[model samples]
Target: MNSSQFEKIKNGKGFIAALDQSGGSTPKALAAYGVLEDAYTNDDEMFDQVHEMRTRIITSPGFDSSHILGTILFEQTMDREIEGKYTADYLADKGIVPFLKVDKGLADQKDGVQLMKPINDLDETLRRANERNIFGTKMRSVIHEANPSGIKAVVEQQFEVAKQIMAADLVPIIEPEVDIHSGEKEKCEDILHDELIQQLNALSENEYVMLKLTIPTKNNAYKELIEHPRVLRVVALSGGYSRDEANEKLKQNDGLIGSFSRALAADLRANHSGEEFDEALKSAVESIYDASVNKH
Candidate 1:
């Protein structure tokens, strides 16, 4: 890892600072923001919309430039050479760190086993990303209740990937997704925490920087969810949720990175009419950040 990257991780201030650095009174905090499938679909209109949304996020009052990490899809990064400079450059120009999602997608677990295929050329991808001056890279592994053996395999893969990322001198945000498609939130938390511990144990030798949980919150079983004892330098709430739902999850996660999907798109639309959506979202972020700092 670069000296600076190591320092960032060592100090573990990246996410916390991202949330707390805004003007003392401004009710806005965002550790990181991401553009999902709509940003990757190879459509001009969609790309333009995402670009506009990115602009709004970077320019939003009290949104710290240094702390904002933007997750860019493979396709977005791929087209950068022909379409424009790498997405990293575009984001860096706006003072946002660019993160690449390296996982192919979710694994299909059936009959208590998960079949996962490796997706990217790690060395090449890291080299390209580094050349582009992107901030970091993220790879996700999934765990299912029916798949104990698969979970062990996935954890091993995550450790290997983390080693590769470290060899490339890049920060790897290790995401182990426990899908919400499962019935009970309590079951999700149990599976998630267990997988997290397993992955951490496997990567004990490596300096894995962040953990991005799929939901990180529960509607039906909030009280039963327990926080891990080790400090999670950064946590991200996955996308595919409403703004209110996103805020609720962030509140539960204690000011981790807030990764939004439909909520961000909706906010982008609201921006056109000068609505209060931005303020509302910002307030939610501020509350989480403040509460987290106070707890610390």
Candidate 2:
């Protein structure tokens, strides 16, 4: 994608829907709609699954080649060696931009201190991945505490990682994910707003670097309205909802970008069943996009 197209994706209200089961019993049609399938397994069976996903996405009518972005898990892609490069090439051939998820899973924390070590040799890994011509990469870190010191530390870490990623010529999807599972909607909103402010401040301090997307939760409409445009180029919806519910939330948010988890897995299966699933997903996506536009 060109810089303009990348900016459009970054700034526009789009969807970053997932395809999480590339290695399992996933149906083909679902992969077409920007599914981030688990194509990282080394087993021959997993390779077959990844192939099926690739075939399905490339051929599916419901999948918008221009709008789709595919993600590969670091573990899966790294283990498969040449498979990683092949996967990137395959997605490019299908007109889909490929992204790598580069977090070391969730960190183990203790008494407000993260016990896990930072990702080592990140620069080297990114250099190799770039050689394969992957389009983008995402990295996530948790802010365990809502206090000022913790928030400052999280922002520092995020900015440092983002700088490193950008230096490698990779668009970073900086995710300071505040776990929604912990608090009520009101509390969640407060935490999210606080985090968003801090993240933007850090990005600004770094001369407002270019980013691929920012995946954040929807807490309050006013907060989103105020903060969305100021932070990252694109505002991405977080995971943890069904397809129907996710569609509904996207509609409600209007111009905001939508991302998913189980919804993608379910939608992929739905696509294999035939026309019903295709129509529903397409209609829903288009409708949300339209609604978001209309609101503005």
Candidate 3:
């Protein structure tokens, strides 16, 4: 990524709202909203409902540039228009940088590591995103255990794609989420930190990347990485925590801001009136914003 692109992302101040659920995740979200998966006529039908969810999120009351530095979009939502306003343009106008989720989804589990499904059409997607002026991109992989081999696999896959993503002039949010409930959370963080240093050392000189780690067991588990010159910003995911719990952990993490979905979107319903929706959204944003402000 160029200095200009890096500056744009830096302007985001580490608050990224991840609304880029793929087809598989869309179904669960739909089910939670009372839509049955069997009720859909086709497999990819949940995308339609997800679009509605996206609309609600982007248009929700009190979601301004201050509340959200950016939003990560699903491929479908990336191209959508609301009230005749294009998605990317809509966000940019509000000073919220727009990013896209390029990875299709996760592949079948392998050696206890779950990697993101490759994006066969990534070149085309990157081209489209560039044309539309998207600020960055994000991809996810899961770390289920403390195995160094498994952690290495996840880190390599994320960085492999990250190089290509940065080459396209878009910042990459490299997410290797260690399962929060794992008994090995602390060990996994240690392993992941070592792996991250090794992986970055192999990158070309002057390369930069962002991290979206699962909230680590220790608030400062990634202190070394957070201070690394090539790492722009480190952010955290809720990793199944409730909104309140997420806030508590997020506030404790000295260098990380939140890139949360469930925690940020917190129980906002589709049927709420405009006043009610905005009120709920404002509350969520304020809570997260307080936690995100650097206190160290």
Candidate 4:
């Protein structure tokens, strides 16, 4: 583990940028960026376009470590290059720590929750990540309601996988997202908080993990988790929230930082010229940064 990178994540005053749109979600992400489905003929071409978008974002003046502490990368992104350097290495050079999205994707919604599908080659994946100088990993699960058993299962699965990631000397951002549209959203957060606390308490004093969760219904809802000894940090995902809404809710949480996807790119368009794109990205980064690190 790189102690410097670990320290930056532990105490950095910035949010993480989530650019890890995988196969399942890439089309939507690209469409939001103004690249429609008709733009690409095949999966290879599709990945190429998305990678170009990622490369442009990374190389842009608006993207750097000053207001962006880290970034999460899709496996394909990790396997690609940017400016003659490996993607992870380029991020490191730009002073932004890099993380890999390791989960295969989500399983069916059973018991009112969607768990991560089995990662058949997680060890190999971790090995590749380490070789690429990746700093950490992110995996996600979803809870659709306030089912205690379901939420518990989600947390358990998250932590179980986290142990493997930690063993590889990489931090794990365990994310069990409570669906923003769930009817029992508040109750779901309550159950999730207790379940997470239990898991945090079970960790050894020397062990540490990060969390990426949906902003809860109540302000500072995960305050206890944020203060837990084993918790390195707790960041909020935009989920389905608009950028403005996500930023507004983010400011209400004192310790939570943003790890937004759709929200971060809300102002950007694929047709925009380089100057326009950079300006839009700059605006988004500044607003999200303020909400994350300079909260009211």
| Number of backbone-clashing residue pairs for each candidate, in the order shown | 0, 8, 0, 0
Q: Write the residue-wise lDDT of candidate 1 on 1-296 in tens digits.
A: 34543454434322321111112111121212334443344455444544444445444654444443344444344335422565556555655455666655556665343434575676777787677776556766555554555655665676677678767766676666665565544565665566657656544544555666666544323222223323234555444566565555655544354544334434333224333546744654454344333332
What TM-score goes with each of the models?
Answer: 0.65, 0.68, 0.92, 0.99
TM-score of 1: 0.65
lDDT by residue (96-134, candidate 4, tens digit) is 999999999999999999999999999999999999999
Best by lDDT: 4
Candidate 4 regions exceeding 4 Å error are none
Runs in model 1 with CA error above 4 Å?
2-49, 52-56, 59-63, 66-95, 111-116, 142-146, 204-206, 215-232, 254-257, 270-296
- Any idea what lDDT model 1 has? 0.50
Best by TM-score: 4
Model 1: per-residue Cα lDDT at residue 158: 68
* Backbone clashes (count) for model 3: 0
Order of all candidates by lDDT, from best down to worst?
Answer: 4, 3, 2, 1
lDDT of 3 at 252: 80
* Candidate 2 structure quality by residue, lDDT tens digits, 1-92: 24643554555444554433433334333354443345334456545555555445434565564455444344354334333446566555
lDDT of 1 at 223: 23
